[model samples]
Target: MFWFFCAALVIIVGLAILTPVWRTRGDNGAETAAGFDLQVYRDQLREVERDLTRGVISAEEAERLRREIGRKVLEADRRAGEESPAARRNSAGWIGAVLALALLLGGAVWLYEREGVPGMPDLPLAERIAAAEAAYDSRPSQTEAEAAAPVPDRGEIDADYAALIEELRAAVAKTPDDPQGLALLSMHETRLGNLEAAITAQRHLIEVKGPDATAYDHLMLVSQLIEAAGGLITPEAEDELARALQLEPQSAQGRYMLGLLQAQNGRPDRAFPIWRDLLEEGPADAPWIAPIRAAIPDLAWLAGQPDYTPPKTAMPALPGPDADAVAAAEGMSEEEREQMISGMVQQLESRLATEGGSPEEWARLISALVVQGRADHAGEIWGEAQTRFAAQPEALEVVRKAATEAGLAE
Candidate 1:
């Protein structure tokens, strides 16, 4: 019985092996090699194209079918190609693609490096312009009277202006041909109340700098100062202003200052026409417009009147600092500087303890503080003066004005 069972198992195993060969032969019997039906597919595609050309299918319909068939064929081709050794053979083609990508990246980087295209936004142009304009427009923000005055420095010292003057002087010493520097120096000297020095600097500036706008401004300002001091305008000053007028034909400040000279020289008629022309051409919001208009009515009233006589009050000479304090401030160490400043404050306090500082002394102290760049100390001193000298309005007012001009006001 065991031998019969073994014989049946061998027969079943033999049939299992032979069955696969038979089925494989049968499945491939009607096809050619490589398991592909190439002729059948070719015939099917040709029949679809013929139908489209014969108008049996619409163009869009033919296109859609063509796309579908193309997608299927391409997918099949890829699958077959992947299964074969073709994918491995195409390594050079992949390298070519990599090289193409590298070339594209290199070109992009080169363009970016060469061009100045900003990578990010800065402050907007309009906002920057508005901020700049706001910085210059002191009229609406400050009181009308305050706006009329020059901006003061830290301790009523006009330190920045003085520094600018010193720098200009140094620059002129180094390079005498620097006209812009000379003109700037002239402006600074004028503000420092050194009219003769200012006029000399401006004369040099006009000769060297030639047609500068600021030089022109300095020339006008210097001319006005000369006329105010009851001095005749020098030939050099006259020539400088004439050149400036040529440079800026519509220079309102120049015209006004020239008119001031004319008025002072007892030629009201000459001054009147020049002023009238400026008033006609100037913007209503111009800084000098209101003053010019005010002067016009006064000029009309004084048409036939003699030129206004100069005031006889002899202007006091500018006071220099106390020698000891000047030397100490100049020579002191950082700690010693503070001590010197404190001592000055104490001296002022002690002075006020008795009869209080004179207005001139207050002005001098404010000037000293400004020269030393001690604005806070100056301010504290001013506050103390205000408290102690409240009964002396003249002194308080003078100190307060000095403080405001020095930019020490709270």
Candidate 2:
């Protein structure tokens, strides 16, 4: 019985010892599997490196292959470490496996929470579109009713127009002498189909500001409005334009007005010359060139007539010292020179009003008028000089050049 007991104890001890060796053998098998996988990965890495060195594969491709192989090797190593036979043989190993599984599950959940699981990010877009469609569908009956309703009548429309007119009228009344207000009034009247009122307002503004580009712009608007109303320039309109020309002779506005005035006054002869001169002087892309060209077909036959000489208008002379003044007044003081200029301006204004003066006196007077804050007056004289000296274009050109050099135009 003692021998039997001893034999049983020895058997149990032997089995216990062998169990750990078996577990070690299983662990070795797992380790060998992992090592084999590692070797395979190392082989792939070496192949990629060789390909890169030989220029068979690009650096980027080799790097990607190496990274993939490394990831696979690392996963195999981790699996082998987690599931070794030695770990399974020991009670602690089983406990470790449970803990590892728990850790893996928790890590997976954490990763999913942090980096997101694949294919679940489109929820917001779908929800927003659904909400929009629902909102749109909810109001369909109201939308249909609104679409079927009749538009408001003209009385309602005129209420807004009347309000606008009152606002503009009040603005004009508040700033009675304001040229900008008057111009706005003119434009408003024009849009409202009141061309005559537009013209009158513009004319009043011109008289207030004297001859200027702003006045010319207003006049051009008036001219277009009037032509739209009907043809023929009225006598009062002509007189007002003549005053404008007197203020700025070389002004395109002045010349354009003069052409209209002459055409309406039964003198196409005069009008044709002015229009031709403007056409020659204007830029190729000038806004008025189109209208002037359209009028040209009507005047092409005039070119063949005996009285037609393609009347040349001179450019307005700029303000400056005349040759005689430069020569005779070299020894004068600044004050004395100013006094002389003042006297010359008076004489020129007087002669221009009367239409009786030599070109030399006219030149001096124009120069002096420019010096006396009458640049618009000088511009008108220059325009007139161009028309009057149509037969002497070169001489008038020389006179204009000299006036410009003497600061007459600026």
For residues 174-282, could you state the per-residue lDDT of candidate 2 as single tens digits?
A: 8866889887786555545444566667666766676454535544443533333233344444554665566567877568667755544444556677878887886
lDDT of each prediction vs. the true structure?
A: 0.56, 0.58
The residue ranges of model 2 lying beyond 4 angstroms of the native Cα positions read 1-162, 207-225, 303-410
| Candidate 2 lDDT score at position 157 | 21
Error of 1 at 263 (Å): 2.2
Find the 10 residues in a row with the least total lDDT in model 2: 149-158
lDDT of 1 by residue, 271-346 (tens): 7777777667655533334455657656644444345332233324433348877886887799988777667755
How does candidate 2 fare on TM-score?
0.33
Per-candidate TM-score against the hidden true structure: 0.33, 0.33
RMSD of each: 30.3, 30.0
Best candidate, TM-score = 1
Candidate that would win on lDDT: 2
The residue-level lDDT of candidate 2 at 263 comes to 49
